[model samples]
Target: MSDASVPKDRRFPIGLTIATLVAFVILCGLGVWQLKRLAWKQDLLARIEVLKTAPARPLATVLAGKGDASWTRVSVTCAPGQAETLPLVYGVRDGDIVWRATAICRTSAAGYGAILLDLGVVKALTGQPTPAPLALAAPTQAVGVLMAPKSLGGDRAATVARFAADKPAPYILMVESATPAPAGITPAPLPAEISNRHLEYALTWFGLAVTLLFIYAAMLWRKMRS
Candidate 1:
């Protein structure tokens, strides 16, 4: 290699070295955090698998039982002659952004109030959100996996109103209707989502930290030779 192409005297400055060390420590910390997350996720998935085989109970019965009933499947009845509610949100499926049409069902049960069932989806059109009335106007029975309300960022007042209004079942249920949906609308099935990709994520962060250490060592070697 030409002298011009050679690296000049590179100083291993204490500040740079310290900064790199701090970053390396942070990266490793993140990897360890991910590993802990993996363990928690594994335990959650195991619990869900066990819950699935158990027979469906009335929404009230399941709610009465313990240990975070999120993901427990249940049967619910929609009150007749009530208007369908539409909660507009955006979602991702297979890496594509799609419109989420969540249909709300006002329950007839005595204790719990209302439930939001997935009203399938519509291909998002350019420049505007998909319109309302995307689900059936009639009432029906449903089978769904109950879940905690997804975070709605920082809109606390709106969140309280949206999630707690009309005394919704403590948990949100993404249900597939036992009855047919409105014409042109598809049945939104309950998602069996149990993610355990944290181990892979941890490995990736650990790999990057190791790679960076190697690169730092190579730089030091070149500087010493120069």
Candidate 2:
């Protein structure tokens, strides 16, 4: 015959119980944080997309704030001495591999200081960059969208420092002149605004957290019954 009363000796293991609870809390916390990130990322992407379509403003107006300058358009004056090509970053343009030469430009405005300017794209087929630094003929006005240097690895701050010319702003602006890029270059189109996968990552984190909780509960129930 089966015993009607539960065994008096049976009890939850204190250490295991504590560990499970801690893990459950941590997982749930991560899930909540991811939800918050999802909203923020969505809003940022939307704002950037809008900036891509909006009319261009003066460099000063665009530089007034960096909060939403991800793709904000601006026009500025540039000269050969004011711009220095730092390094090249690569991307696909029209089914062809191309390298973008990002340079730092010290604009005419003293208060605005300097901003990294993306000169434009040089085709991989061009080979070895021709190494002609963006030396403009004279002081010329240019227009572009603001961008931040992207680090494929390591710290972004360090990357920015390496490219900086005379303490430029933390942001980079992809500038294309109304006339044309210097030479061996074409305008680098703005990258897709919403290509970042933060939303998917957030959902994945939330799913993992839910799965962890469900498994923990099942194990706890089974342990109690035994």
lDDT of 1 by residue, 1-226 (tens): 6756645565445675787798899999999999999999888778677865866678877876777877777888777655545545555555555555565677745466776665555554212444553434534777767767652212223433674756766566655555655444445444425468999999999998998889878877877777
TM-score of 2: 0.71
Local error of candidate 2 at 12, Å?
A: 0.7
Instruction: Please list the C-alpha lDDT of all candidates, in the order they appear.
Output: 0.64, 0.62
**lDDT of model 1 at position 225:** 71
For all predicted structures, in order, the TM-scores are: 0.69, 0.71
Q: Taking the tens digit of each residue's C-alpha lDDT, what string does model 2 give over 86-188?
A: 5556455555556666655666553556665666676534444334444333225678776665522113345467634555665666765644456766776
lDDT of 1 at 17: 72
Q: Which candidate gets the maximum lDDT versus the true structure? A: 1
> Candidate 1, which segments miss by more than 4 Å at Cα?
1-12, 94-98, 108-111, 122-129, 132-138, 151-165, 180-183, 192-196, 214-226
lDDT of 1: 0.64
Q: Count of backbone clashes for each model? A: 0, 0
